[model samples]
Target: MATDTTTFKHVSYLWDEAKAAELAGDEVALLIYRSNLLGADLRLTNYGGGNTSCKATAKDPLTGEDTEVMWVKGSGGDLGTLKRSGLAALYVDKLRSLKNVYRGLEHEDEMVELFNHCIYDLNSKAPSIDTPLHGFLPFKHIDHLHPDAAIAIAAAKDGKKITEELFGGTIGWVPWQKPGFELGLMLKQCLDENPGIRGIMLGSHGLFTWGDTAYESYLNTLEVIEKCAEYIEQNLGKKGPVFGGEKIQSLPKEERLSKAASLAPVLRGFCSSNVKMIGHFTDDDRVLQYINSNDLERLAPLGTSCPDHFLRTKISPLVLNLGTDENLDDVAAVKEKIAPLFADYRKMYEEYYSTCKHPNSPAIRDANPVIIIYPGVGMFAFAKDKQTARVAAEFYTNAINVMRGAEAISEYTSLPRQEAFNIEYWLLEEAKLQRMPKPKPLSGRIALITGSGGGIGKAIAKKFAAEGACVIINDINQERIEATTEEFQEAFGKDSTAAVTLNVTDAPSIEAALANTALAFGGVDIIVNNAGISISKSITEHSIEEWDRLYDILVKGQFMVSKEAVKIMRKQDIGGDIINIVSKNSIVAGPNNAGYGSAKAAQAHLSRLLSAELGGDKIRVNTVNPDAVISDSNIWAGGWAEGRAKAYGITVAELPAYYAKRTLMNEIILPDDIANACFVFVSGLLNKSTGNILNVDGGVAQAFVR
Candidate 1:
């Protein structure tokens, strides 16, 4: 469908050189920048709508030589802040070869094969359905936008003529075509016809442009859309009649009217216009005359501004004319009329499909409209969910505006129906549906672990990496950090983990660590605050330095990491899980742990407070209080267990068994146990269980029996 030119002019691009540098190289930075440009343009038309891609050369595994690869934006990724991992890389040659095979394969089966052939870059996520289009383009950089200004014009009568006049011969125009295979073919044809054209404008669809470089492609897109917006603004005002003055259509019941009223806010939210009910009879003659016009049929094929938007809005809105003497307030009557109309629409879709399909190439798709825009009444953009609905409404609103303006010139035109169908049902477009190994339950998921070089921290880091998460292992000891990273690389492939030597007490170190983590893993999805220092001196004898060190590592470190992790998590829309490793001293104080006990106690309270405050964003913060666990690092070298045993006058040999016997299992607990507990805390099973402490110390500390 046509996009709104006005909306295109207001589109903004998001770019950050620092973020680009963090991504590792200029090539990735360029990709992110171009993706953001496309994202901004699509957002102007439909929130979270559209996809973009880049084709580059990568070393092939089989030949060990450079081969073409398509780097496409992943599904469900927000383009505004997309990172390198947000893109999925697939072999471009493989996808291009599929175009030559015209066996009329089932879309779903072919999709599976395409996905099977798809290869994920070490960092990127799964590619979007539009990956094939990127492969189809000859240029290195490609941009696809569902621009409101363009869709608006494409959706109106004489849309093609308007596009030709406004954009002229420099821009190739393709008729309305479904977005996958058909659109690809139409685009190919346009390229063949106008080899020198800068871009192709899809009538009743969107726009496609490419360049040799990311910047060039992005700038070209901006320039073209800006021109389109200027043309629309100069020719036609982007305003519609206010719905407030429309006569209210009388329904059989008040409830029916109420339902319509309820929908008004939603419509107004998108259209930014007041809603009023125009009774079928107040201006019966005018309403009927308008409905009876042949233009109604002509507008039917305008379809959706883009095909993916179909998931949000239905195909089209029903044309309704209220009858005189009908009950003006009956909700049931309204439902009755609407329900039957959907059935009729379904039947009509089937008939259309049957008429259009060729014996050798015919295939059927679900009979659902992307959106329905009522002529007199405000439009109802329906999607499978609210998110989709919002996206559809945005695209529809812009498309309508463009259509209205284009009608000023000539009858808007679109690609043939069959062409649109091919694009909508192209095998390449369905590739994303293929099943792959479920991301290691944590793939694309990030975890920041403190004290990750030793004991529980190391265990947790390795465990998370084994489970498919990219781990950011943090510790104060440089040696431990490097050693732990080495151990993790040995256990889980080297590419799965990163190590950062960060002193928890240092703010700059913490910030740098977080920045590095974001660059390495895109963003953190989980934080395990396991770093802490313990002192055994009595409160009166303990030095201020010792106390401060304890608090800094246990309390301040957790705070700093949590704060930064939460910021990234919130922006990424995946609420993170923060598990603080507190001691049983926080729940049960003892005689000689003034410094350690106080710090642990503060950490526990901090966890509780963060849980309460961040719960609104769905972030789960909790404490894991373990009584005591014997580890090589913690027992032999002035570790907590060794110090406590010395204070109790116990032998090192007896200390391990003594603590084990104190627990119900009488089994010595390893660091892996604590790591496993942390894993459980971050998993979905504990998604709703936060703000409380989980005691994983066997039976040393009983719940509610301190």
Candidate 2:
């Protein structure tokens, strides 16, 4: 490569002193602030794609003297929301000392074992694989990120020459090398050659920048990345459609959901190259454009631009045999082609492994496609679980962004098969996977809660989410649906759950919502049939219209939802759980409430019949009956309370206290109390439990079951 001295550079910094002040002086606090700031910009990195670290002084364990320590981002920490506890601190001197006794290639696994044993504080955490890189560097702070602009420059054919001209000798370059003790040694060599170098660009890898202070490190990264961005913008110049001659593959989510759901099971089975696998669908504008483009068949198979992306994305994705017009009618065709697809993909992967297997590298992981792109319909990521699947999705998204920017400048180029294999099979990245926490009991399950606006249903949604279930907040009110959806996403994650506007009584609406949930979350695992309406009227005074409306929303609604869920669950061949949130009046007679009592009674009976019939299929059915949940119930606020108050010859204001006193324990049931019993039925904690009625009425003898 020829070194040129003339290159135009333009870079800017977004620094806020107030933001820095928010994080106290603690080393972890400063690191957290820096990590969040770097992660805030998708242009810098996306999701869990970057890492940050700092060196500080800490009290020694054996002696009272102070010693140097390195606090690096640990294995499972997310950069965007990094906290003080997310950082793991280790003895800087001790970590670098491992290089002396470390055997060349075979010792990589032992090196990581020793790295964990050198923690400065036992209470700290298991240090990350890249801990040695940061510890070996003689800097207070270090940052490594997969920025789009930087990655585009690093993967280019003329990366070395362009970087030399752009940095003006202020930054050094390290050619593509696998990450480990060797890579750390190479970076140390770059620093020794170029004293006071701002950063180093790794070919087809990531960029590493360090500084005496966190602010300096952050600023240098921003400026250097901005310069790369400028170079691409200047050279790429005017461009045609990023999708080549193809148009955006924008399709209505509803139009494609049912088809996606119907075919997800087949694809999931085919792509599963291990003991377990999950499928997730995503149709982000960019994703759709990439998979549906005319150039997809040519460019997508090229591979990832960054080595760090290999662990999550693998060397190449398994492109399904569907095009822009993929539909459910093709299930038979898909089923026929799926076997050969897997056979061919595995054959290719086996060939690659045999051809490119390095003596030092570990055996190739299962040759499954972590990513699957189906033109028009959208893209799906297959992983061991939902969280890992989301990570693959984020990696794929970043890969496209880099390619889009790079191809415009020249051609999108990435690491070849051999280098990709090294990183994918690296023991360091493998250790990260082995260290992941066990899945929660409800992991990979989906729960749909009706009347979830603000009541017992909403409480159930929140509780199920805590147990690792993806929640679908279904309600007729758009405002409530939006609010509840935001709350679910905040509690879980952006992709953990979805919300749909639905009227339970409407068959089409219920079908659409079920399809939406199935498409987004794969399929339903738990159905909480809690949506209903209450009308307080004496049997003689209640009109036929009242009975019809109550049954329509309560009895028929639950039936429709359960019927739809059973179909999907049966097809999944994975037994499911169904919980019906019935009223205490279902069995216990209540005064002046014939309509609600009769509907709830029918619902409770319906659950028993369904339980008896579905038990053969391994589906559990149960009911939770609560008496008076006075707080946050829409039925109470929607005039049912006032009517009941009038029946008791009391004001609505006095009804709550009266109901509280009526309970034997004087305990007014809250929405969460009902939520607790509802989750018991939904969680399958009682695997043998079926046709059981759990009550939540604070010891009301009339509501007690036999």
- lDDT per residue (tens digit) for residues 1-706 in model 1: 1333335444564445466556544555687776765665553445556667777777887889998887877765767667787787778777777776634434533443465465736466765555665667688888777775666566556666766777777788887655554456568878888888888887666788888877677767776777766666665423432211233443333333333333322222222111111111111233322233445445544554455443343344444443433342453454455556556766776776776665644356546443443443333443322233445556555544444445543444444556555555444543432443454566545688888888777788878888777787777778888887888877875557777878777888876776666434344678889887677766687889888888888899889888866765554444679999987788776777888888888999999999999998789998887766677435245555656776667976788777788788777777888888888887667789889787877776443333
Model 2, range 484-594, lDDT digits (tens) per residue? 888878778877778888888898898788777767766777898999878897788888998899999999999998998887666555677999988789988868988
TM-score for candidate 1: 0.47
Can you give the TM-score per candidate against the true fold? Answer: 0.47, 0.82
Candidate 1, number of clashes: 64
lDDT of 1: 0.63
Task: State the C-alpha lDDT per candidate.
Answer: 0.63, 0.79
